[model samples]
Target: MLRRWREEDKEPFAVLNADPVVMEHFPATLSREESDALAERVEVAFDERGFGLWAVEADGEFIGFTGLSVPRFTAHFTPCVEIGWRLARSAWGRGYATEAARASLEDGFGRVGLTEVVSFTAVPNVRSQAVMRRLGMTHDPAEDFDHPVLSQGHSLRRHVLYRIRRRK
Candidate 1:
């Protein structure tokens, strides 16, 4: 299920952020303090924008998060809303991320009225790329690029971009 983050979500989210497997694609794992700050930012984004990455619940527990957010860096796809997620190791192998992301896309295209949602990941992140494809998003090899935020030659700098347009 998809909903806004509560104060209760902070601790588990912090631990999720610190997991090496979960943080492998990003620059580094966040400290607990950093993760809490990120949760604060997500809450603020929802308040300011009326929507952001939603806290996910399954089996009555806060497993992880999935939803839409604006990418903070400049890319060929600047000004796009992107669908993404991060789940705890315990939550992997379930359909949760795909399911939550579908709800998020519905909210984006239905209630939020966005026309297109983009998702991207480091080139080697086949796991996330697979989720993106499962969301019915399509990629263009021509659209791949080095992430501007990563230093030159960083291992994960190269990224694949996928996009799904709102249905008529």
Candidate 2:
């Protein structure tokens, strides 16, 4: 189930962020303080934008988050809402990300009135790319870009972009 973030989610979320395996595709794992700060930002996003990453729970446990957000960094896709997810390692392969993301897309295209949504990740993140494909998002190599937040020549700088539009 997807719901607003709660104070109790902090502990589990920190653990999820700290897990090296869970953060394998990214640059590095987040510290507890960093995790909490991110959660706070998510809350602010919801208040400011009316939509942000929703905490995902399974059988009453905080698994992760999936929803839409505006990318902080400038890219060709800047100023666009993006559907994203990050589940705990244990929650992988459970279809939670895909299910929650579908709901996010629905909300984006429905109530939020977004005509399009994009998803991107490091080129090495085939797992997330697969999820994008499962959601019917299409990719064009020409749209791929170097993540502006990363330093030049950084291993994770290269990223692939995928997009899906609201059905008429």
Top candidate on lDDT is 2
Q: Which stretches of candidate 2 lie over 4 Å from their true place?
A: none
Q: Model 2: which ten-residue window has the lowest total lDDT? A: 72-81
Count clashes in each candidate, considering only residues at least 3 apart in sequence or on different chains: 0, 0
C-alpha lDDT values of all predictions: 0.94, 0.95
lDDT comparing candidate 2 with the true structure: 0.95
State the lDDT at 67 in candidate 1: 93
lDDT of 1 by residue, 1-168 (tens): 888899999999999999999999999999999999999999998998888999999988999999999999998899899899999989998999999999999999999999999999999999999999899999999999899999998999999999999999
Q: Name the lDDT of candidate 1.
A: 0.94
Clash list (residue pairs), candidate 1: none
